[model samples]
Target: MAQGNERKSKLLGSGDIVVSFEFFPPKTEKMEETLWSSISRLAPLRPEFVSVTYGAGGSTRERTHATVTRLLRETDLKPAAHLTCVDASKEEVDAVARAYWDAGVRHIVALRGDPAQGAGTKYEPHPGGYTNAADLVAGLKKIANFEISVAGYPETHPESPSVEADIENLKAKVDAGADRIITQFGFDNAHFLRYLERARAAGIWVPISPGIVPIHNFKQVSGFAKRAGATVPSWLARRFEGLEDDPATTHLVAAAAATEQVMDLVDEGIKKFHFYTLNRADLVYAICHLLGLRSARTDASANAA
Candidate 1:
């Protein structure tokens, strides 16, 4: 076990923490406006890279492509496009990977997405599709030398029969050429630490970036957690207690909660994070600022002068 003072010193010391944000492609014009507004607000922060999420079973395939291509053309930010092997055949999936490569997107978040039937349902791979994430990773590698990031589950994946099995699956993805692991959002810092230890013990050496979702709406996030198999601890529930009637207070509480969570991870020696931004930037921006991230626009303006 690490000494308490050692952990504290590590947290207090300077480290270059890399951050990335995830946004889903919008489904409608109003939502598209909101999504771009949020993207513009966060683009100035100079995140390591921003990712656009693909919907289940390639539901948002076209929209996700449009969003990613726009980011490529208009922004100074690096974009990571998400690709999943849920409903598409191997040929179709490979075509998409080739398209992204030709479009100059060099990073991908590879996932074995949830069933099109919805959460908690059994996943049936398409007869001609890549069977799982590892297979998809290998397929993408064949198409291009893309940097691939695969999902990790601190709380075992719902379909995983055991934690040991889940680790093995993660190892398979790594072996298949994944570049990094971006975990599913987790509330408890201890869970992430333990998961990291387990991954190391299993001989997986890729950088595992902890996913952080600042709780803008407790009820909504709780539902998401339930579906994703992340545990919302009692302590976390208590923190949001009685704030339902006040949006202002909820936002403040959410920022503080998320900031503290990240700080604790920093104390434990983590230096990278992936934020699930949910198409809203205020809370994520505030938390990033608290973590000492400054807008690159400031430097750009000074340089221009």
Candidate 2:
């Protein structure tokens, strides 16, 4: 029998999984309403934690703080606020970290942010800032015993001259007291698997959660992937082709592709996942359901309280 036709054992019944989500701060009142609605919808699945994103050059600092604070005040979800070393002095950055600590925010997703001009532009460390993510991680550790999650690039960061350099940089962050690593989202599972092996070989053993982005919109997401140095595989592109004018069909393909990716990863013994939710719920909720996760009464009860 051809290998393609060979039957394989079932892989979808595994309910043992840990998941987290990432959402950006809202810029307007209507956007804020939409953000909270999505939060309410996904709250029942009980994500391990949900993260709120910071804008470039720390532009959305206040909004990110507001969103995170609301999560702590109103929901049962653990919120991780993103902190970046971008266009701010060490003193300025540390003060923000201290505020998060005082606000009951414990986990931080730290990154050496993109250039102020935006991604694909040159990034120069601020003269008085922590210099880079590794330095920022160590600085954050000193300020508080916060749980720090750092970024990892599976296909190599665009600025890095080679993949080896990126791994070394990841190691520096790990050595600087980062507790976890969440990768840039990518569509290729093989790249992620190989990155896992390389990270293990390099002696960085912290939990590295693979980042999953459900294709809320394929074209927009592909643009994001290009900016963040992640790959948008041609085969994955083909799945979305011709669906541009048909959003309903596009959504169906998106669900199937994301489900297929996670199922394959589960077969490889990966149990932790971090999703770039883009502030949408129905797609992510259904994906979680197909993965055998169900809403817990306690989660919603806490929200009601």
lDDT of 2 by residue, 98-191 (tens): 9999999999999998767875578888899989999999999999999999999999988999989999999999999999999999999999
lDDT, candidate 1, 14-73, per-residue tens: 135679999999999999999999999999888989999998899999999999999999
Which candidate comes out best when scored by lDDT?
1
- How good is model 1 by TM-score? 0.94
In model 2, how many backbone clashes occur? 0
Q: Cα lDDT for residue 293, model 1? A: 73
List runs of model 1 lying over 4 Å from the truth: 1-15, 300-305
Error of 2 at 147 (Å): 0.3
- Stretches of candidate 2 above 4 Å error? 1-15, 298-305
- Candidate 2: 10-residue stretch with minimal lDDT: 1-10
